[model samples]
Target chain A: MTMGFEAGQDAFARAVTDPEAALPPGVTSRRGEADAMRFAVYRNNVTVGLIRALEMRFPVARRLVGEAFFRTLARDYMRHELPASPLLFEYGDSLPAFIEGHEVSESLPYLADVTRVEAAWTRAYHARDAHPLTIAELAAIRPEDLGATRLVAHPSAALVRSAHPAGSIWAAHQSETVTPPRAWQPETVLVARPDMEVTVRILPERDAPFAQALLAGEALDAAAAKALAADATFDFGSALVGLVSLGAFSARTDDEDLPK
Target chain B: MTRFDERETGLPRRSGLGLKPEHYQSINDGEPDVGFFEVHAENYMGAGGPPHRWLETIAAKYPLSLHGVALSIGAAGPLDKAHLARLRTLVERYRPASFSEHLAWSTHDTGFLNDLLPLPYTDETLQRVCDHVDETQQALGCRMLLENPSTYVLFEESTIDEIDFLTAISDRTGCGLLLDVNNVMVSAVNHRLDPYAYLDRFPVERVGEVHLAGYDEAQDGAGDRLLIDAHATEVKDDVFALYEHLLRRAGPLPTLVEWDNDVPAFDVLHAEARRVDGALAAEAARRNARAA
Candidate 1:
């Protein structure tokens, strides 16, 4: 039976993403028969196109797991979810979480974290452009008012804290030969596009709380307190300078009405 | 019909190439003399980045053609408002010389399928497509060119001919057509029809631009020839011959050489485009000689 356009599309889309499903109704070949091979072309295009998009966004993950395994993981992920939007770059936002629950996580414990870093890097690369806060601007605040001042995080700034050294693993894969990291330790990676270039840096362990709080919109004194509570040796003086140098904060606008 | 005279047309009657990111530096440094450069609209929908920076530089030097792949103009539902807003933003930012989209649908109720899937060419779909073209033209506040699709399977329920369907859309909406010679070749072979006959029935007067690309060959379930519209290699010899045939009839419309997958160096693409330019030049000379 012939279906309506909407029904036809519903059937076609269902079959395109599911290999086991039959071809949609009303589809035919010139010879007047259902041609599965001909229909397979659309199936291949959608699956391969989406998988390739993921591969392009997460090259390091693909390299780490090998192309065959990465495709397997991507295919598994596709079974549960498809892109809700046409923006291909933003399609794989949930891939890290998907990988965390997959059985592959048992074999590659750090894979999900590495994917998180890769995902954040892409977000930073495409984030809105803004002028980064300068050290001079920070110094302009009165000494007494500094503790109460709220520094705005750059739109592109993202913090990915991992129990594994995902940042070092990601950096090590940049070259042809992948060498083992010097030490296996936790890392908190900072991703920000201060200017045109996207910068990815591993934050000092103790400063993670401070950067995290500031990024979450905590005031200067409150963020510093969080860092001190995390570690007694937390050096607030250098961490503030380091984050400003890294362009983690946006230029402050006096128009914002701060609450008392 | 909305006839775009020589002055009204945006693209020059020469050969162009699809702009790839790998060749951005080469294009910037060499500043090659070509007709224009075409880009996919969805690729630059991001808020800000190097994509915009490079596009800004390239658009300044060349005539930009914005081709949208994800608009889903043939969908059964209303147009995506957010996607239309983004397209409008892109048009405003680039002020491209030409804008075009496919006649196929990729978005369904579930989500975007990311591939140009086919639809039945019945009177129902024809009215739907005309409505879409009208909506898109109004949204962007500019005329759009709709291109034909290469299909693997046909719909038994389709009552209208592909040519008639496209002609009706153009006539009803006053939109232009983009005749992709490769798509004609591919669709003809898959449907067991003569490519020349398809071109003979095409509304060439309304054509604003032409697209040329390569197709991969395979056999269907019946062991008949099946051609996939894979833009991974140079334009096939048969497709180029068809293009030359088109130019002879259409009189040197703006042509674009598209190589999306397994892209080669800038010089290779430039050379392919030069090959097209050679054909366009010969056609123009023939027209001049006839005039004399």
Candidate 2:
């Protein structure tokens, strides 16, 4: 009987993941060998191509673990988790979680967080294009309506909170000199692609909640309140300046229709 | 801007190279006399950035062919609407002269496998492929070329020959064929079929483009001459001979030298393109001689 589409694909998928698995029925090499090594080409292509994609998405993770170990980690992840989309950039959404649970990566406790920063950077790189809120746009807003106004974050803006100083760890890998922080400290990474270039910055502890709140679609007052709760000495003016400078906020003409 | 019409701006019957970012500066600086450049559509699907910037600059100077790798047109599952929508947006933005996808499916019910998985050549498959091609043509608002795949294994239940199956799709959906000569060589060698005869029987009249790439040659467990469609090395002598045979028959079709992995410097790809151009020139001279 002819192999159904789903049945054939299922067998192929199984065979690709597990090299020892018997070749699906009716598969033979050009020379008519029942168990052809020719099938390994597909297996290699499927696994290697994915591992390469994962490497591209998580370069810092790959660099930290080195090539051989990262390949092992990537292969392990691919065995169970196939990409839900054809977009390779969007693959490995759950890689940090996978790395966290992977035994090989256990020694590098901070590897997961470093991978999280990398993933966020990738997301920011591919996020939708939007014009960032300008300082002039913020200034034009009436003082009375400032508290009530809901600030929009750029689509490319992303925030990552990690127990280890993952932001600094990821940045150090980019340069020739690697400088670990003096101490292991929690870090909040702000990933934004302003002007179509992905830029990562370590956010202050107090500012993390403020940016997170805005990204969560909170109103200006509520976000500020959260920031104040996080740190008693929170400076709203400087934080607002930093956010605008990094192209975090999105400009809205909501106040345009308001009373003069 | 007026939409690009394929009939008016079809790719020239000359040699082109698969555009890589590494060669961008050289290509822009030299403005090499290559016929055109082709890129994987998925690579440029990201938001506006260097990729688009480079593509825009190169496209302005030369003809472009947007070759898609993840359309999954032959999948048994429903077409990925999101991918299709993204493709449409890209096509609209770029206005590529020719767009093409492979006959093999890379996606299934679970998700995309990222490899061009093989399919059986049966009446059911033929019909399904035709339907998908028709849908894709409608979605892109243009006729796309379906590329032949290089297979490592064959299904026992395959009822039709690969050529006939591909011909049937072209006939049914009015799509053209992207005859990857290396693929024909690889698949033929792997299956122990005559590559020349396969090329002779191929429906070249339906061809819209031609792809030439190198393959890795090794023996399988049974010591059979196995060819891997690895676009890593230079075009092999056998593959080049087949390309010559194809050019003699088809006469200077739009050919692309695809070297994806282990990509060499611009000089290498440029030299390959020049060689193909030399072949095309030779074919043209032969045609002129015959006319004389």
The model with the greatest DockQ is 1
Q: Which candidate should be chosen as best, given TM-score against the real structure?
A: 1
Tens-digit lDDT track of model 2 for A58-128: 98888888899899889989887999888888889899898888885568999988988888887887776
On the 0 to 100 scale, the lDDT of residue B127 in model 1 is: 92
Please list the residue runs of candidate 1 whose C-alpha ends up more than 4 Å from where it truly belongs after superposition. Answer: A253-260, B1-8
User: Clashing pairs in model 1?
Assistant: none
Q: Give residue B99's lDDT in candidate 1 (0 to 100).
A: 92
Q: Estimate each model's TM-score.
A: 0.97, 0.93
Which candidate leads in lDDT?
1
Docking band of candidate 1 = high
The CA lDDT of each predicted structure is 0.91, 0.86
Flag regions of model 2 displaced more than 4 Å. A253-260, B1-9
Q: What is the C-alpha RMSD of each candidate to the true structure, in Å?
A: 2.0, 3.2
User: Candidate 1 residues A83-149, lDDT tens each?
Assistant: 8889999988999999999999999999999999999988888888888889998888888888877
* Model 2 Cα shift for residue A21 (angstroms): 2.6
lDDT of 2 at A25: 73
